[model samples]
Target: MRATLIEVAPRDGFQPIGPFIPTDDKVSFVEAAHAAGLRRIEIGSFVNPAAVPQLRDTAEVLRRTAHLEGLDAQVLVPNARGVALALEAGAQHLAYVVSASEAHNRSNVRRDVATSIRDYGEIVAGLPAGLRLRLNLATSFDCPFDGRMEEDLVLSRLDALLAHREDVEVGLCDTTGRADPDHVFSLAAKCLARFGARTRWVFHGHDTYGLGLANVAAAWRAGITGFDAAFGGLGGCPFAPGATGNVATEDVAWMFRRMGVETGVDLDALLRLATRAAALPGASPGGRVRAALADRCAAA
Candidate 1:
């Protein structure tokens, strides 16, 4: 099966790091990822610069990468204000994040589940006809504040969001990185069976428990073709305590390629990107492939 890997290194990967990455460095990172054949890349988020200073230059980053051929640039939008900013900056694709757990939602975005949904509907209704919108269900699996979430709760929220706008894509986020393979497969299977054709499903996992790749495989078997990953596995939820970075882009590419599934990414080039991302100040690489390959080369 062919899958689409959305590289989120410039945004997700850099956000968790404490130091501020120069705007030029972020632009270079996005360009390198695009050069490695990543068609979709989350460049940055339109959030309060006071909250996440690392991504303060999101608008500038988007402007710098707007000319990349065959690249679908996406930015995370928190509310209608974010949508307005993104549109002003010429962003065609915008992702809004809403947590399945009410407590987490409040903590992350300062709104409860219902309020977030209401806000999302307004944003959807106001979008241009051709604009692409994605609603990310953060804490779809487990919530640091509320514990494990019920599958029905997740689906019900999805149903409500779909009722407001069926065109929006859905992304299931394991914000706490607590999802097991079986649980991932079951929820993903149910979501696909119910809403497969109406909306696109994307899985975003964190490797905090070392099961990120396993969960990705489970989701894939359940008919999911879209995934979000970061170079060198760098990212963590700013609201969810103990959450780690996302599954490494190079690692996911290697897994899919080994399974005979095409991801359209160049493995060697991705590893190089990972290495460069890890070199950024305050950045740490959590991926396994780069180190493993280095060991093999040394042995040779």
Candidate 2:
């Protein structure tokens, strides 16, 4: 009944903030999310610190999280160099992002679609068998600059990636938050049918146009359970201009619990994490439900 949740607050949620977040605050955020029972978390990205000032403390974050039990600490690696850095830092799991849209992929990672796929295949090939590698396929649903993404393109890319390496896990990303229920169901159905039980699909929804919740429902019905939700909805796509934050962790967890789906997440403790998020400089906590929950906690 309980579905696995990947808390992306540390990597996806914190990276897009306009101001610099203190490294200690980042540690507090991850620790609080762990207290809320988030077993899997993408803690940091091994990108250039000059490019992403927010994640300049990637090594430091990894070091602090090394001793935490019952936690799957992950880092995002864009290429082999990043992968090497992640492995050096003792990350048990690594996530690599590849975009379905060719233009977005180039803009985000400075590589064309084919080259990016090749790059990812190399990363997957070289990774130790026991370590987990998650491929986050961004712009799976739609792209701001490039209109709607073709399902065929997404599947083609998946086919190549899976064919190259069988052990990789795939994550479908609503990069611009432009996805709807129908889109989510169709794409997810395609993925589930093709992959069967061999691969796990993780849904990454953005609440940009208010379709995030509906998309989650569609994904759930399509048998896609694993998801990426940020605490207090404090995350956005750096590449997609004007994209909003992710679905709030508390909101999604509340929905699943009401529908008799167990998330194994403590809403009260999660709300406290959101409060801590709000205290971080430049973090707005865009989720309405999270704000309401925080208010209730304050009143109590």
Candidate 3:
């Protein structure tokens, strides 16, 4: 089976960089990623300019890429204000994230978990018809502030979110990249069993401990086909201390290619993109395949 890869370099990968990437270049990235066979891409987020100056040009980026055919442009919306901004920017797919760990949630969104969950329901109700929705449950297995989370607590919070909207695609996020593979599989299996009929599942992992690929395999074994990955592993939670970039998109694609599980992504094309991502000023890129094959590609 083929894995559905969502390219988030434009949003997740670009946000942490200190220097602001030009909007034209950001739109070009979305176009380039789509050309490489990724139909789904996180274009940008609708956050406050004072908070995230890098992505303040999200609406312009969205307007520029609106003409791309078959491109599923996703926008990350944190609250009702973000939702309104995203809708005004013409975002058709929305990714809403909240942390299950109370400490992490408080630190990340400046609110309690229950308050965030309640706001999510209000956000969903006000959305226009035919909009796609995805929910990312961050710190699903571990938290930077709270440490490792047990299954019951995670499930109980998930139960609450699903009650508000069960049809949205659910993402089990390894926000801190400190999750164990066995624990990942166990939680994913339970969620699928409990919510598979009503919703879809995806795994969003980071390679902080070099176990991102392993956790991805575990989730796949648990029957999840969708995944969120950033090129050159370009992402880190601003609120989660000690967390690193995400599971590199090229690394995940190569692993699946070797396993004969068609990834549908062009690895050579992905390498060139990764190289560009790695060169961005103030950007800390992470991925094995891009470096391992860089010399060979240059020599060839």
- Of the candidates numbered 2 and 3, which has the greater lDDT value? 3
Which window of ten consecutive residues has the lowest lDDT sum in model 2?
291-300
Tens-digit lDDT track of model 2 for 1-300: 777778998988898887888888778778888888888888999997777888989889889977778888989888888898888888878899888998899888889989988888777778786998888999999987897999998999889878876556788999888999999999999999987787888999999988887898899998898989898887887878978888888788888888999988988888777766756777756666665555654412
User: How much is the lDDT of residue 8 in candidate 1?
Assistant: 86
| Clash pairs, model 1 backbone | 235-245
Cα lDDT tens digits for candidate 3, 242-293: 8889999999999999888987898888888888887899999898998888
Better of 1 and 2 by TM-score: 1
After superposition, the stretches of candidate 3 with alpha carbons farther than 4 Å from their true spots are: 295-300
Alpha-carbon lDDT, every model: 0.90, 0.85, 0.88
Question: lDDT of candidate 3?
Answer: 0.88
Ranking by TM-score: 1, 3, 2
